[model samples]
Target: MEKRKEILNELEELSPILFKIKAEGTDKNIVVPNGYFDSVENQFLDRRMQVENEIDIDIPTDYFDNIESAVFAKIKEREIEEESKTPKRKIINISRGRERVRLSFLPLLTKIAIAATLFFFFIKGTDYFKSNQSIEEIDYLASISKTEALNYIAANTHEFETEQLVGIEFTEEIKNVEEITSEELNSYLYENINELNEEDFSEIF
Candidate 1:
């Protein structure tokens, strides 16, 4: 008890303000607004509800529901487009009659056949009609029209090749014609002009 009293006296002499505060005693004097704690939860809820109510956005009807199907449909369409672009070529025979045709690259023989068909369809239509041939009356321009029974190919050329048809252009014919030099033509003519007379010319014509 004597040691305690000596310690207190030393503290008081060292700091007189601290000594007076200790002597007087003290209580917590912090002031808070009334109902501040009680209203905290209510204020937070009100702010959250206001934020929720204020958020207004528009979306199309059924948009979310149909999104998956719409995406699939677009994917399928793109797949079909990719698949349709193929390198394989399609060749259509005029005899078979296809919807789509790219005939520019047909073989010479195939082109000749197609040319013959076109010739029959276009040229002979007039001649056969002139000869009183009807659709029912004539057959495929008739294999039996000539006396000898259907000898398919004749040696006669100007009469045979579709290009040799009078004054008409065979636009589809792919035959190559070699250029005749003037010297060659002159030499041929000098040699054969006598032999190529009126009858020969007439026959050729």
Candidate 2:
């Protein structure tokens, strides 16, 4: 410690002499007050020679040997503690910021399945109506004539009343047949054809 203070004092006192060495003519003359100039000049020359010759540059082994390892350990521990105290920044991955989510999509698939089921049922209903329509004139043999068959069916199938049955009257296609009721005609039509069972009569027209 004493040696460090002595070196500091010497550096402070000799700073001006070293600064003068860089002046224009100081290399030849070195102007200063009488006795102080010579003393400062000798110190400057001695320091300059020591630097030029590389004297006292090598570190002594005793410097490391005599040093307190505890002091160095404490200093290193303080440095590590200071580093630990500093706040760490969180890192964000910009490449993954816009990634799309991976989802199961089961609900969407269920809705599509339901809609397809409804559509299938609607198509089935349309086909059923088209195929089972009884009013269409597909069975031409059953109808005698267009206008006559309509008039005959309409007049015979209307409501009528007599002493025995209280319903519509009907006549047989055969000659001299007993009078029949509309309920019997309905039963006959229902038994003969499958489409007439749904009330879509096709025999007349």
Best by TM-score: 1
TM values, all candidates:
0.19, 0.14
* Residue 108 in model 1: lDDT: 27
lDDT of each: 0.41, 0.36
Q: Give the 10-residue window scoring lowest on summed lDDT in candidate 2.
A: 163-172
Q: Which pairs in model 2 have colliding backbones?
A: none
**In candidate 2, which residue ranges exceed 4 Å CA deviation?**
1-55, 58-61, 64-75, 92-205
How big is the positional error of residue 103 in model 1, measured in Å on the Cα after superposition?
Answer: 14
Model 2, global lDDT? 0.36
Model 1 worst lDDT window (10 residues): 146-155
Clash pairs (backbone) in predicted model 1: none
The residue-by-residue lDDT of candidate 1 on 1-205, one tens digit each, is 5797787798799999988886777544657789899999999999999987786445456766764454334434533553466233333332222322123222222333333534444545434334542333113223233211111212222234332221122222222111222343335435656645564444222
Error of 2 at 176 (Å): 99
